[model samples]
Target: MPEHEDKRPLAERIAADIRKKIMSGDWVPGLKVPTNEDLRGLYGTSNVTIQRALQILKDERFLDGQAGVGVFVRGQGSQTIMPAHYIAPAGPGQPYRWLSEATKRQQRSKYRMLKVAEVVPPVEVARALGLEAKSTAMLRSRIGFLDDQPAELVHSYYPVELAQGNRLADRRLIPGGTPALLEELGYPTRSQDDVVSARPATTEEYEALEIPRDVPVLEIFRIVYSDNDKPIEVTMLTKPSHRFKMGYHLEAS
Candidate 1:
């Protein structure tokens, strides 16, 4: 190959070359990429240029740098591109069932219903549930565990008309939980929309989930709707970001 001196910035050129190597499988997952020294010698560039190139790869989730260990390639197959703000879709069904299935299949956890009650909705919650302020509603909370380790916290709210006087609102109702209860009442679930984001956790959240303060939490806001387009429930789920990875497949719009 001819040594043509392209006018692009040194960092940009280095990043492009490294990307090509990855795409061509020259550097596979967990493989050590070229070090700063190696890059400096190969490209006849300064340390600054090499550092910038490495940073770019890291930001793209293609690489992870350990404190004492060198930078290693992160397999492309495990990469997540969603901004963590988009919600996952849940089909119509019992609210508890939808949550339980997601926890089992996606997060790999065992879910346990913590509490259920018939109570007046808070102002913000009432608005989301499309009910009058302070109107009665059903509230449910659950904790998910991965082999005894707490993994996620889930809180769900349902309209009083759909939840009150139902077996789902009974505190002693466990095991099959909400989904089964709803199905028994002839109100099978249909679909749900998930909204996710990342943020610092509150003290209560950190303690309840048993996570460190430095660990970021993934918050998912979900709205479960029925076949008639009626909002059945609104739920909030939280988990440690490092403990779980979110995935989605998209096509050209």
Candidate 2:
């Protein structure tokens, strides 16, 4: 069939054509996709149409482009989860149970520990955790995946006192996620205030996550407090903005 005979929307048709090639492994990860000129010639379309199609794929996290290095296929199938209701702790012995229920309802979810260390808390982090500056803290950074796809990078700070002598820090404690670990240490049932913003990725972040410069990221600040309203942890979550949607429900006071 003549490619020009395909009368579909230019961008959609282009994206569909490329997506098929990707799925068939014709273009592997790190392999450059057809250039704008290449695509234009193949589809008999303008550079603008090709650009739009490429942009769509980039937003979908299926392609990564370098300033002068060209665009490359980023593999296929990365899932993203939208933020939902902020689950509140019900009571003692109930928080973990409730969390399990909440997570089950999540449309998608995944996580990977990136870095874990014991270090002195920074001034801002200490203040958030209600501790003195220079106080020891357990810093854990993770890259969360959703449906087997990279989603967000999260850095969590916890007072060292909370993790002292706890086996939860051990990598072998796989099933016991961070929240569950806290619960085991008797700091369950917490509440969080989430603040969100959008910005471009820093050089370090871009390299670490292999994100393109044109992509903006969503930064989420989560301050968690115990049931008694004592701040126990602070988390910073950074995610590709285009891949996610943040949703919340507000009730009448």
Candidate 3:
């Protein structure tokens, strides 16, 4: 006989059950979630643990709770309206295969240029780029929509001398994409570093993505280096946790 393994933490297991229902479409968007007291009894847990379970789904954007109306499911079809970290194809002779959305998925996405200007870099960005504190860089900010859903907000920075008076300063998609454009101009991206984190959305980001203020975001800062090892581009991208997810595949070392 099985050892009757029930060692998983109560709150996590409770949250897992709710998460499954939402993901499996049994409780789809607008469907009400079980009440706190109901969940408490089902899992034989206290009010606090039950509340914690619900909070997990809320954080994941799988459930929305109205003060008086209780909690309801939120649809999960993010891929229908999201973009991948790498959004370009690998050219002939390229060593690595580019990971991007399918052609149909690409057609469903759109982007808007929000701003393009020269600004003194933030301290962290300045450090990343090895620039003086007062040095200015060309900043290009934009928002992307996938299937009419706001999917991401990105801000890219480059040395002003390299970006000014170029298409990178213009408010539109450049031909062959930015990486290709940069390569044609001799700053080919040879490698990049990415740092990922999550936190509550700021007011501006919350509004841009139309997500609740309490919703956390997956923020990634990518610093692209040229063949000469110069930091040529730094981009910060924010994706709503509820509206986006990421996956990675790696070969065994």
Number of the top-ranking candidate, with lDDT as the measure: 3
Q: Higher-TM-score candidate among 2 and 3?
A: 3
TM-score between candidate 2 and the true structure: 0.62
Model 3 lowest lDDT segment of ten: 95-104
- Among all candidates shown, the one with the greatest TM-score: 3
lDDT (0 to 1) per candidate: 0.68, 0.69, 0.74
Which window of 10 residues has the lowest lDDT sum in candidate 2?
90-99
In order, how many clashes per candidate? Answer: 11, 1, 0
Tens-digit per-residue lDDT, 1-253, candidate 2: 9866977678877887786666556767778887788889999989999998898788667789899989998844332343443344334444333235436766355556677888776677777888775677788877765556566687778877776777545533234355666666688746788898888987755655557545678888878877688777888878776555466666899
TM-score of each: 0.57, 0.62, 0.70
Model 1 Cα lDDT, one tens digit per residue, 169-201: 766544455645554666656766777899998
Model 1's number of clashes is 11
Model 3 steric clash pairs:
none
Candidate 3 per-residue lDDT, tens place, 1-253, comes to 5679877678778887877666556777888888888887888889999988888778767788899989888755343222234634245443212113434345366677899888997888888888987999888898877667788888999887778667888877664557776776788877777788898888879999887536678898889888778998898889887666665544799
Model 1 residue runs over 4 Å out of place are 1-108, 173-175, 249-253
